[model samples]
Structures are given as C-alpha cells and as structure tokens.
Target: MASDVEDGVCFHCLQPIPHGVELSVAFQGDDKAVCCAGCQAVAETIIEHGLTAYYKHRDLDKPQQTPLLPEQLKELDVYDNPDVQSDFVRNTGDHSKQTTLTVNNITCGACAWLIERELAKTPGMIKSVVNVSNQRLHIEWDGSIIKLSDIIARLARIGYQALPFQQNQIEANINARRKGFIKRLGVAGLATMQVMMIAFALYFGVVSDLDPTTQQYLWVVSLVFATPVILYSGQPFYKSALKSIQAGSVNMDVPVSIALIGAYIASLYAVIIGRGEVYFESISMFTFFLLTGRFLELLAKEKALKFSTNRLTYMPNLAHREYDGGLEDIAAKQLKINDIIVIKPGETIPADGVLLSDKASVDESLLTGESRPVTKATGDGIVAGSVNQSATLRIKVTATAQQTVLAGIVAMQDAALADKPKVQKAIDHIAQYFVMTLLAIAAVTFLVWSWFDPDHALWVTLAVLVATCPCALSLAAPTSITGAVHRLNRMNVLVKGAQLLESVKHLDTVVFDKTGTLTYGQFKLIAREDYADIDTINAIVSGLEQRSEHPIAAALSQLSDQPISPDAIQNYPGQGILAEIAGTDYRLGRCEFIQIWHPNWQPKRQSNVILANRQAVLAEFQVDDEVREDSHDVICA
Candidate 1:
C-alpha cells in the first residue's frame, strides 16, 4: 500500500514482488531473507536453532565485533587449570611477561590513541603500539599473571583480530597488498587524465584566448579541475616527503614533492597574472609520470617485504612447552627464556636455544642462505628460524622470541629502508644542483635576450625552465635498477636490494664452505672385509650406528643392509660408539679405538674406519667423498 521501494522488493525475500503478491520471509537487521513460505519456515527454524549470530555476522560480509571480555575469558577455564597455565608459561617463558601485543586495527592516529587508552586500562600492560600501515600491534604485558590469549581475545572483541605469524596466510596478505596498490594506482591515473585534459585546453588556446573575461572564466575551470589532481593524486608524494623530512632523511619523494609544489604555485601565478601561455600542461603531465614511477616502486618494495615476512612467519603458531614431566602446545609468542621445548622431526625451531637431546640435523638455509643442513647434538646451540630436518629434538630456550635470529631478521628489514641503490644516489647528486643550475641558466638567458628583444626574455626564461626539467635524470637510475632486479629474480638469486647488486658486480673474492658446499658431505661405502664369527660385529656396529646422524653412521647403515638391534649402545663424543650385541662387545669409530692391535697404523684420510677385537685387527672399511657436480663450475663462474 505504501508503494515504497522497500515494499516492492520484499525485505525478507530480497526480490521484487507484484503489488498483490504475498511474502512470508521475515527480515532482521538490514539483511533480506530470500525465500518462499515453506523456505521461510525453514529459515526461522534455523535461526531458532542458535544460528542467528551466524546469519547476522555472515549477512554483513564483515568481521563480527564480538569482544571477549576478561571475565568471559577467565570463565573459558583457561586460567584456572594450573597445568594449562603452566604449559603456556613454560613455553613462552618469563619473556612473555614483559612483552605486549601491538595491534594493527587502529585505522588512524585517533584509533591508535583509542586502542592505547583501552589497553592502558588493563593492569600489567606496560605499552600498546599500533602500526596502521602494516596493521600490526606491539604489546608488552606481564606473563606471570595475565595471558596472551586473553589479550588477543580482548582485541577481537573490539573489531580487531590479532593474527599470529604464519606462513599459510602469506598468499592472502600478498594479494591484499597488490589490491591496495591497484586501487591507488587507478585513482591516481584517473585524476591524472582529467587534470591533463583541462591543462591541454588551457595550453592550446582552446577557450582561454576568446577574450579577457572568457580567459578568466577558463582559468577558473582549469583551477577547479587541477585541484583534485594535486590533492588526491599527489597526496602520497606529499605524505612521503613529510615523513622523510620528519625523520631527517632524504627519499626520492622529497625532490618530487618540491617539483609538484613549485609547479602548482607557478601555474596559479600565471592564471592570476592573465598569462595562459605558460605550460601548466607540463606540470600536470610530470605529476602523472612521477606518480606512475612511485606506484611501480611501491609495488616492488611490497613484494620484497612480503617474501621476507613470509620467511619469518614460517614457524609454527604453537610450540610444545615442557612442564613437570609432561608437555603441552602453547602459542610460540608466549615462549620465554630457559623454557624447554620439544621439536618433532620436520618441525621448525621457534626460538634460539640449547639442544637438550642428542643429534639433530637442522636446515639453516633460510636464515644463513646456505644450502646444507648442520648436525646439532646435545649441548649444541640451535639458532631460531632453522628447520629441523631429520630427528626429534628437545631444547631449552636461551633467548625469548624477540631476542632470537628471527627477530634479528625483522630488525634488519626495518633498517634496510634506508638502504639506497646506486641509481638513487646519482639522482640525488643531480637534484642537489638541478634547481640552482636551472635558475642560473634562466637568468643568463633572460639577460642575454633582453638587449635583442624585451618580450623575448620571458619566453627564453620559460623555455630554459621547461626544457631543463629532470625527467630524464629521474628515469636514468630507476630504469637500470628495475632491469637488474628483474634479471636477478629470474635467475633465482634474490639480491636483497639494488645496493647488493653493486656489491655482487664488484665482488673481489668468493668463499665456499668445505664440507657441504664444495663436496657431497654424505658418506658412501666402497667395500667391506669379511671375517669368521664376525656377524655379531656387523650386527652391533649397524645397530649402534643407526642412532648416530654422522655421515659415517649413514654409510655403515647402508652397507649392513641387515635388521640389527644392539643390546646396549653408548656414544663417546669426538671418538665413536660402544655397543654390545649377544655376548660380544664392539667399538666403531676413530683409529685410536683399534690402535692396540695396529699401533703403527694411521688413517689414510678422515673417511677410513677400522674394526678390531681385543687382540687383533679384524677388518677395515674404506669410504670416499666426491665433489658436487657444480663445484667446478661454481668456482670458475
């Protein structure tokens, strides 16, 4: 009867209905429920079955703002259970007590202030920092009493989610960056085109040369069109320049900012003076080109940041924290110094710590850029961010999360912002004198041309200023750096930055690690000698060696090819293994273990192994290692 748009489109059904058509679907909030009478009945049944929140949260297609209050979190029974609390405390160590979460949900400085105020209300929270650009929060809190889950759940209630570092989320994060860049680029491009069109009309005497009054009218039109371009399209440059100035550093944006501001003021001056001959089109075009370059640079930087961030985030979200004769998985961030953590095979070590269990081969390639795995034994120190390749390890954390190698990588990335390429330095050098040189040339030209013709001086000065713009100089460095970076990326060698490329090109010496880098460090069995009644020796050596991750152990295991179990096995560091099988005892290792029989015998190389009984040498095994196929070429190249 109302004949309103809302009545025509059924609020619940979300479909246009004839004026007399009956609709049975019920509407809630701002969402439409599209259904027939029977379907509406089913929908109501679903909502009554505790699915209303699901529909409401889903209908909005936005993150639900369901804040978990501290009291509710406590009731979740997380704090009451000493075992759970101790597990979390042990895994995160005492360092979690001093750390705080800095959240990224603060959309602006005002939002940041508001979140900080809320966090400050909570006891034991020393600080809350928010970085809006990356959408990260740094929080410091006392772990002795408060818990990280409580903090995270509290943030979630306020419409912000605290995302722990994780590798699986990398693709989504990268996509978001790409989308943001595309949106900004689109807006800047559209504004650039509109401004250019207005500038062109004013430049070519389209409507400006009609009459004095008409020229004034045209000037107003140009100003109206250009305002959006300078404000919206040029905002990034202005912001970047201001940030650099505040930090007392010079970035590429500083010169671009100067140029844009100068062009805007000069163009406005021309309009006021009733002179439309000046090339304001050039200024608009320059802004557009400069912004295009900046967008490309930002895209490149985002890609690099994403790659390094993903690497740092590869550690598991939770770690098994050891407590009074048991273990429980807790958030990795809660891990503290001196906490024992059990790492299963194929799991990454989450923090820098000391290995408590014996023998683990860890892949440190991601952090050190090395391709080989390092064998770590009991009492050996393990760096954070390295991947455990083969055996399970239990480690006592020596440093907290923020004090580990992963944190160092994060710090290095932050410091790398100041790292500039060779091309940027060249541009900076040119920019230093560009403004002064242009002014001097314009002044000389004006004085020289005034004697010949009074009107010619202004034209000469404008010509010098316009033609001598630093477009070519700006293009020179970025073009080369971009090409080099692209080429290097194609080759699978990710140079950290353009500055690193210079270091690569000028490298005077190259170093190689002898063990895995130059040679296949894995051992291969050449041959084995047989002896009577020595099946026991074979069985004992193989069983004891299976427990060892050393290259020699691997070689022996392959040669024996027999299922053997040692009655008892003991490892002697820097020597070898002692084992007993059946009624016989055996030792497998250095020549010193068999030196009683062959006192004059010495190993030809480090790869040889000797077998002996109490009275005589029984057998000897020879092993050899060969260089990697690429070793020669890598050295020569």
Candidate 2:
C-alpha cells in the first residue's frame, strides 16, 4: 500500500501539500519527506543553519522501510568506503558474522510487514523481521555479498533510517518512554479532576436552587466539561475496550467501558427530559477512577512486557555471510538452514547452528539463566543469542530463523500472554452471574416496592441496576496482580503476565533442572600441579584441552595464558585425554588413572583427576562444583 504521508499534511512543518507535487525524499512512517530535491536541499540548509523546522514538519505516520536486498544494495558499495565500513563493522561486528542493528521510523504492524518483506527480496538474504513497537529491524545476510550501507540507503529511499543503538541509547529510550507515560497519566488525571468537580455541582442541584431557567445553563456547562474528559482522559480505555470486543473477547476494560457508557447515556436522557436528578456525579467519578487505574496498569504491564522480552531482544539483528570471498551484511531474520557465518568474541550467535571451527566457548546464560560458559566443539550445536566468550569461530546454520531456541522463548511469551489468568476467569464468571442477579434483583425490588409506592420502586430499581454492577469485583484481580507485577519488576523479576503471577501462587512442586539451574555451572581450576615446570604443564594442558568438550578440559584450557599445540591426541570418552607431548606419553583422567599407573598411589575421594606418564604418577588435580548461593534457600523456602 502507498504510505499515509500522501494523504496527510507534513507533521513537521504543518504545511498543506500542493497537488501534483512529487516527493523528492520519501518519508517513512516516522519521518518527514520534502516535496522536491530543492526542498530537501533547502531543508538540509535549514537544519545546518540550526533551525529544526525540518524536524517539526516531518510526517510521523511514515512507516519504517525495509533494508535493501543484496542486488539492490550493490548500488551503494558500502564495503569500498573505509570509514562507512569501519563504522558498520564496529557497531555490527565483523562483516563475516551476525550482529544486530536498531532502525528508527517503525510506526505500526504494517511497517513491520513491509520491512520484512522487502529484505527477503535480496539474494543470499536469509531473514528480516521488524519489531514495530521498538523500531528495530533484525537482518541476516551474507556480509561478503551485501553491504550494510547499501541496505540502509535503500531504506532511506523508502523514508526509514537504520541507526545502530549503543547500550546507553537503549537505556535512554526506555527512560523516555517512562517519562511519556507519566506525562500522559498526569494530563488524564488533571482532566478527570476538573470533570468530577463539574459533575458534583450538577448532581447536588447547586445551580437548580438558583433559578429554573438557570438549570439549563448548568446542564450545558456540565456537558461541555464532561465531553473532553470522556474523549481525551478516557480514550485509552475506549480504545482497549473496542479492541477487545473486535477480537471477540472481554478484558477488564470491557466492563468499565460498559459502565461508563451506560451511566452517561442514562444521565444524558434525564437531562434532555428535564429530569436532571440522575447520577452524573457517579458516572464522572467512576470514569476518573477507572482511567487512573488503567493508566497505572498500562505502565505496570509495559514494564512486565519489557522484562520478559528484554533478554530475547538482545540477539543480533544481522548476520554476515561470505559471498565470492567478500563480506556482506544481511538481516538476521533472513537466515536459513545451512548458511555459514562467522562469530567473534563477545558477539552473539545469530542462529541455532553447528560450529565449523575446532572449538569455542559461549555464555548460555541468556537462554538457561546459567552463568557458565559452555564449550562447543566442531559439529556441536550452538543456539542463537549465546555470547561467544573465547576466540572467533565459524558455524553453519542448522536451524531456520523461526525454529531457534530464542524463537521458542518468544513463542512462550506469546502463549503466556494469550492464556487468561485464573482470577480473570473467575471475574468473568462473576460478571455473567452478576448481570443475571442484578436483573432479577431490580425486577424483584420494583415488584415488591411497587405494591407500596410506584415512585419509590422506580428509584429503587435504578439504584439496584447502577450499584450492583461488577466493576469493583472485576477490578480486584487486575488491581492486585498489577500491584504485584510492579513490585516484582522493582526487584528485577519480570513476570510475563498476571496469569503467571497467579499461577505462581498455586504452584505446589518446583522442578529444578540439574545442570545449570541449582548449581553454579562454571568450571573452576581448583588446583594445578607441575611435574617439571608449572607453566609448561599449563601450556601442554591448554593445548590438549582445546580440542575436547569436557568441562574439566575447558577449565584447564582457560587457566593458561601461553599457547600450546597438542600432538597425537586420543580421546577416552567419559574419562579424559590421552596424548603425547614432547615425546612423553601421558594419560589424564579421573583418580582411577593414577591408581592404574602406580598401584601404591592412593586416589582422593573428591571429584579429582590424576595425570601420569608411562613411567610413574605425575600430578593430581582436585575440583569442586559448588551450588548456587540461593539454591538451598530457595529449596527450603
């Protein structure tokens, strides 16, 4: 679809667009476009002259454009520009590896669809996914074939700009969102208060006592005051309620919307009929409280959502691939199975793949919440988003973009959000029964009171209908869960939803995963003994350990600063390494190895390994795996 920019005035300059004027620069959903090249040239001049009118006049409805395809991107030749390439590589990491990029100008879900679709058009581009809410585009491509600058420039033509986000910038953006929510809440609160005051005067008949004709004046004043409050202050509630109904579901906002509308309509009827004794005051106050609660709940829910999704978002958006022996940058979302990519130290793995290199160590804490780094060997599986802790490594993608472990985490979050809380279900049940009960009570009260006085019965019926609404009862669950979520967020525990919190209160058995859950999974060098020289032994161990995936071998490899290469190494599965170093044959395994070498040597009972040459025992190493500090406390609690 064509962008909404053509239909609307420039938001930045607030100038009316003339007919038949072609756009010189296309504005993305969140940016501004100039009508001609002359306008753009002048606009740049204006910005250079320190006037921000260009920014002020920019269209905010323009959606973020997609990254360029390898063929389309070839026009820019970013790799030839050393400065651009350096900046790109610095921000995104090596062009042969995958890294993330944060794009600005994403506006809505449609923009996300467009960007993803556009990037997929590129040859050698594996995947591209745009997150509209956060304005980010994750791309995976063969860096050797595609240049990031070319891709970004193509996005610029469509009115979107991709900017790499520094860690500090992400934090600043989060703070800005918080400030906006606060300001919105403040505006709504002030408007609500003013409306409530006008409602109170109208309800108490303060103006009615002045004069009969003046009562109409008071009603008009009240209507004028309440209109803006309902339109502006309660807009979020209205939008949410409508969205819920459209989706064929009822949320907490549905009842609130119904109550507000019902009260307002009834009060409007009374005023029009010259019987202005209706509860307008109740209606106004009800809306005020409801909006206040909603605004607060939105803030809490946003925090919870951020917490649950933050770790997943840390994955790089782009992966580099080798094409014709040159580097190219592509969207991470476009990555497919069997694609080969490089990974540098401190860079995140972009997909579930098998390492092409001999060995590498990665921190898997993002996925399993474990602090230990896992050593992966050639042909070993590596999940996306795992941070490389050692030297650079190459891997061939084994899974597509959507089938990754991180993708599963995102799917889990989505499932969690879709599942209703037990409390919400209970509230739904109560609302159903409450509606029927209120109808019955209103009828019974009218019938019983009508026998005595018809007028009294009418008032009693209205009271029952208005007072018996399940607003407060329905509110109980959301309010409590929202409060609890806020508290948990403050403590750094992000609950995915209110339902998760509710489920936590009902959990009877906690199943702990043994490997990384209850234990401090990191391997430590408890002791190192040198037969001839400590440094020589360390270097030899590091060299031989480099090829092994055993945790003990990984720990020993990390302890030495010197480089060493192993010769004639042989692996003893479930035991240890048997190799020849400097023409000396040595076997390194559990304490049993030493006992076999020297019958007189006694082995320690602790988790220890002994090293021995063909002649006699050499040295013994003991290690201990400690449980996490809170493991026992959590178990006992």
Candidate 3:
C-alpha cells in the first residue's frame, strides 16, 4: 500500500509528514522531515547540541512549542549594543544594570528554578528572581562583562524565550495561569466524584457480596480514573517538591507531593498484581481536596490584593498632550518631563507636574487623605492620581510615569508584599522543618509496621503521611488575616498587610482625620438671606457655581435643577466665579467678592455664599457642614 515516492515520517516524533512539507532539518548527518515547525526547531536544537539520542528515547506524545525561528532570534542580538539596550535596562553603580524580562515556556516552578540557577552561574550575574505569578524574571548583572544579549541567549539555550517585559504580556500570562488552574481543578473534581462512587459501593459491602473478580475489576476502573488526577492535576506539587529539594530546603508541598505520589504508585501496583487492598479512592480524594484548598487560597490572595491593583484605575489611559498648533491625544505613559498636558475638569491628572494655568482646585482625598479639594496656581506642583475638580489647567510634566508619587506608593506596597511579618516567617520556618520530620516518621513507621505485619505496612504508612500533613496548620494565620482584611475593607478601613493585625492587638490609641475621613466635607444649604423666587435664585446661583471648583461650589451647584450655563464666566483665584447670566452681571463668592457690589455686607460667622450684582446684594446662601452620623460614635468608641 506504500507509495514508491520518498515519503517519510518525522525523525523526532516519528509522525507522518505530508508531501510538500517545508519543515525539515539536518540531524546527525541525515536530512529528516519533521511534522511541523515546532518539531523542526526542537530537532535542530537537539542535533546542534549533539543530543540526537533524545530522538530515539523521547516520549512521542510529549508536547512541543512553536519557538521563534532563527531569523526572528537575530533581533535579540541588538541587545549586545549598550545604546540599544538602554531602553529596557537600568544602570546601577559598578557598571551594572538590572532588567525585568518576560520568559515564555515556564510551565512549572522547576523551570523558574532552572532559569535562576543558570543565570546565577553566569560570571557577571549578581542576582536573578522569577515571579511565577507574572512570569517575569528580574536580573541584575555587570554590563561590562555580560552583555544583555548573552543573558537572553543563555536562557534560550535552556529552551525558554526571553524578551523585555511588557504590561500587556504579563497580564496575558497571569490570565493563562488562572485558566490552567481552573481547568485542572475541574478535571480533578470530576475524577474524585467518579472514584468516590465506586469506593462507596465497595465500602457499603454491595461489591463485597460480588465475586473476587468483580471487585478487582472495580479497583482497576478506579485506578484508571485516578491516574490523570494524580499526574496532571497534581503536577505542580511534584515540580515544586523537586525545586525545594534542589534548593536544599523543604516546604509543605514536599510532604504533600510525596504522600500523593507514593500512595498512587502503591495503589497502582496493588491493582496490577490483584492481591492487595488498593488506595485508588484515597489518592483521588486527597488530590482533589488539596487542589481545591490551593485554588481557594489563590482566589483569596487575588481578593486581598484587589485594593492595590484597583488604584491603577485612577490614572487615565490617554491624555491630551500639547503638540504643534494643537493638542494630540496620546497614551499617558508616553508623557515625558517638560511636556505640557491639558487636563479638563473632572479628569484625573496623568503625572506629577507643575500647573501652568493661572489656577485650579484638585481633589486629592484619595492620594493625600485630605478631604478637601486643594487649590493650586501657576508654578505649584500638582500630583498625579488627583482629579481636576474645578477649572481646566495646563500642566508641565515634572516626572515620568515610573517616577510619579503614585508609582512610588505602588512600589512601596509591592515591597511590603515581598517582606514577611515576623509571625508569618516563624510559621513558614516551622512548616519547612515539619515536612522533614514528617518524612522521617513516615519511613520509620513503614519499617516498624513491616516487621509486625508486612501485608498492611503500606496502608499504615499512607495513613501516617496523610494524617500528619500540615496543610491546615500552615494555612491558619493567613486565612484568618485574609478574612479579617476583607471584613475591614467592607467597613471602609484599609489594612495594607497582615502585620497590621499584629499591630492592632497592641493598639492603645486611635486617631482620625476630619473632612471626608471622619466627617462629610461637603456643605448643606440651610438658609437664604432674602426670600426671592426660589426657582429664580436656584437657577442664578447654579450658573455662578458652575465656573468654580471649590468644594462649597460643588455643594451649591448640586442644589439646583436644570442649571443654566453662563453666557460668559471668569474666576478669581481662591475666590469664586464672575458670570453674566440672562444679560445681568452676577458675582458668587466669599464676603470680599460680595463687598465689591454691596459695601455694607459683612462676613457671617458661619459659612455663607453671597451673590451680588453692581447694584445690590441679590442673596446670601447660609451653609453648614453635614457631619457623618457615625463620626460621633466612632470618636467616642
């Protein structure tokens, strides 16, 4: 049935190659066709490294990646030049620079460890850290000795693709991680249910009444269902265990992985030989429960970090930058120092900059914890992440995206996450040693039980491993702290870290900031001097308040319905709005602006909004602070 033509199978995977396929590479002096580009690149790499023996022994079903082609890899060579690398590298003292790289093909914790170790062994490398959540590798090295290209090339040799870190790419990587976790959890959960069904049938003696062959057949079915759960669903634990041992330390995962794998293997042997009691149900149940707990923990961590991650929404994605003859909209991150950016009312400031306009009021309650809108004028610095509350303003950037005050706060929060509280560190240390001790006990129990009863030694040993795991013990503090944090967040209290819980226990005093922090900062219109037509007065006052950005102005502005836009408007810095409405001039401000029209008007002891014209005082709006009801109770308590 074979054709006479020279049709061939892939040399690497031994899959049939179609005619006209271009995926071929020279391997061990023989030209061989590969099934696809991914296989072709892998074959070339193996042959180039004199590892063609891998082709003869590798699992044919092993997955492969479509790696970058040789020509595409040549672009990375630009990193060899200092000038070209400066965009992604930051220089420190001693001719060293640090860079964060996005590494692809990191399927497990072991891959991260391998990349770190390989980088550590390089001559000029000082440090390397891989963040598994974001798949980002931070590296510091002596640029004088190791070029950027060299570091990237070495990681590529280890079968990972490295490039400069991009925010979008990192986000995609995180999403991929969550998707994978959810998929594995689903598979494990399904297997657990199926295994438990068969297990319960045997437990209830329903299958015990059946013949020996029938029970054996049920055990084999359970084994078939549990294999994928133990191997694929629980693969991360195995990889983590391997890395922990390679690092000369132990963690909770080591004991967990050992117990799961050991139990599964024992069950497998028993099922194959058909002479011993099998643990297929136990392995399935254990893997499913452990994975469920881990998935919940990941969700909890994401929820706890939501407060920090949500802050990024305060910065606008786009800004109107001043350009030749007009303004152009550009990404906020592209802003540079000395460039002028135009921020309109109600929009957030893009960066820390100096206000170039005459004046504006900015709401900085979120950034500085100030409940009031702070007024800024020409030459005054306006911080990023604050809203432009009143007037349009042109600001000249004084800091780049990464150097802004908001960025610094985010950086501090990240640093806090990296550090462990004393109690947490102590717990982790205990857990690490606990794993080592548990392993020793498991081995001893197996040997001692074997001496007394060889037939049941494996089951007793499995009991020792499962019953003694410290998963719940290690999770206690973090789970309690995370729950407490979520509760506090609902009550408008933001606790930045678990260390706060430790500090709260010793608290002797409490302090609070007034104005939005403890009391409502806005004003309530309580009275009016003259009983003019309420509708007419409301309309006129709203027009005047529309041009002002003061907090009081906002309160007064909200009291009107169908507010009329003034035909012309002008603002006095720190004063109020001057406007012409319906062919009549009106001034709305403090007593000073009112005095210009009515010299007899005097300052009221309480907060008052005075409206006037060239002829006389039109109205005086009396206002008062509407304090929060809970403020009194909170203060007393």
Cα RMSD for candidates in order = 14.0, 13.6, 9.9
TM-score of every candidate relative to the true structure: 0.48, 0.52, 0.75
Error of 2 at 510 (Å): 4.8
lDDT of 2 by residue, 1-637 (tens): 2233454343222233334443443244334554322234333434444444334443444422222222322443433344333222322234433334555434223334445556777665655555333445656566767766656665655545564433333433444445645665565566556666766665566645656566666666666666555666566556655654453333445445555665666657767887645555565666666555544544554454455354445777678876777667886756767888888666888888998888877888778766656877889999998988766778899864445777666544433433347766555456545655666776898799999986566566666665665656655554455456547656545466557775676888987765555766666656545456667666766777777655556666665788477668887544567888778888777766556667787654354766778796666666545567899898899
Better of 1 and 2 by TM-score: 2
- Write candidate 1's Cα lDDT for 1-637 as tens digits: 1112253443322333433334344435333433233224334444444444433433322222322222333354333233333322223235443232224322222333335556777776755654323344556577655666667666655545554432222233444445655665666566556666765665666644666676676666766666666777677667655654453333345555665666677668778897735444555666667667655654554454344433545666679999998999886767888899998766888888998886777878667655446877889999888877655688999865556766656534432422446556645456535645766776788798998887556655665665675545644454455455645555444455557766777888977765555766555666666454567556656677778755556677654568478778766644666676676666677688667556886655453676665555556677555568899899999
TM-score of candidate 3 on Cα atoms, chains taken together: 0.75
What lDDT does the true structure give each of the candidates?
0.57, 0.58, 0.69
lDDT of 3 at 625: 61
Measured by TM-score, how close is model 2 to the native structure?
A: 0.52
State how far residue 151 of model 3 sits from its true place (Å): 9.7
In angstroms, what RMSD does candidate 2 have relative to the true structure? 13.6
Worst 10 residues of 1 by lDDT: 60-69
Q: Candidate 3 on 486-547: residue-level lDDT in tens?
A: 56766666566647777887988987867665766666776677546667778888867865
